[model samples]
Target: MDNSETHNQRIATMTFTSVYPLYLKKVEKKGRTKEELDQVIAWLTNFDEQKLQELIEENATFEKFFQQASLNPNAHLITGVICGYRVEDIENPLTQQVRYLDKLVDELAKGRKMEKILRGT
Candidate 1:
């Protein structure tokens, strides 16, 4: 495929949200205080998707990931790489992760097609 086609295909096929819940589960399992959880949630709320995409492209440091989580109270107890690259909870595996990502890809493709048709692209 040509470069543009390959690039678009990558964007269309890449999956990240599948692991988001896995990350959340790991965060929740640490028994963090409510304040700490809130802080992490706040960071998530304000998180910039584009910046995160850039970080992913640049090979985001494990330190950077932890720093993002550290903004919350009780962060002192949390030190280590986040989950999702590889799931720690083997009992539940990643079957759900793949399903969630597939759903997201479908929704996104539908939205993109809808937008293009609206704009007559």
Candidate 2:
């Protein structure tokens, strides 16, 4: 297989529970609360606190986590660079979804207000 398939496979196997705390801590360290972080996540994935917690407890992989997600209609509006690639330019849907969350968290940690971070949705 080529590099794109390999990239997608690597991301698909990653556990959502593993990256969650890092997202939380990154926000908290910037004086942003967990609630704020969760809010942005909910906006993107449509996973409420209970569902998010359940996924974590179940040790869901990124693939399963996204498969169950109801992506926000405006999720496409979340455009920017994450992990050196522009989120909007990512050809793989799964990678784009993951980067969408990352970009939102990065915005929150940078002190952008909720409405702005949520892209006014």
Candidate 3:
């Protein structure tokens, strides 16, 4: 199999619950709150607090989590480098979505205002 396919498969199989705590830790260490993280996540994925919790309890895979998401139309407005990858330039849609979340969290951790972090939503 090719490298791209392998990468996608690996990411797709990752559990959202496993990665969520790390995201929480990253933001919390920077003095950001869970509510702010959830707000940004909701803006990006349309998953409210209850729904997010449900997915977490279910241990949804990254692929399943995204598949069930109603991505915001303005998500395209989020553009930046995350983990050395440009969010808008990613060829893999799933990877781009993941990076979009990362970028939002990064902004929040950097103490950006909620309005700006939500991309003026």
What is the C-alpha RMSD, rounded to one decimal, of candidate 1?
17.3
lDDT winner between candidates 2 and 3: 2
Model 2 RMSD vs true structure: 2.0
TM-scores for all candidates? 0.24, 0.95, 0.94
Return whichever of 1 and 3 wins on TM-score: 3
Q: Name the runs in model 1 displaced over 4 angstroms.
A: 1-46, 68-70, 73-121
Clashes of 1: 0
Cα RMSD for candidates in order: 17.3, 2.0, 2.1
Tell me the lDDT of candidate 2. Answer: 0.90
lDDT of 3 by residue, 1-120 (tens): 123888878888999999999999999999999998999999999998999999999999999999999999999999988777777888888877877888998999999999988878
| lDDT scores in order | 0.35, 0.90, 0.89
Model 2, span 32-58: residue lDDT tens:
999988889899999999999999999
Error of 3 at 109 (Å): 0.9
Candidate 2: count the clashes. 0
**Can you give the lDDT of residue 118 in candidate 3?**
81
Q: Which parts of model 3 are misplaced by more than 4 Å?
A: 1-3
The sequence of per-residue lDDT tens digits that candidate 1 reaches over residues 30-119 is 543333333333342233556555545655443343344323232222222223322222122122223222332332333334232122
Q: What is the lDDT of residue 68 in candidate 2?
A: 99
Off by over 4 Å in 2: 1-3
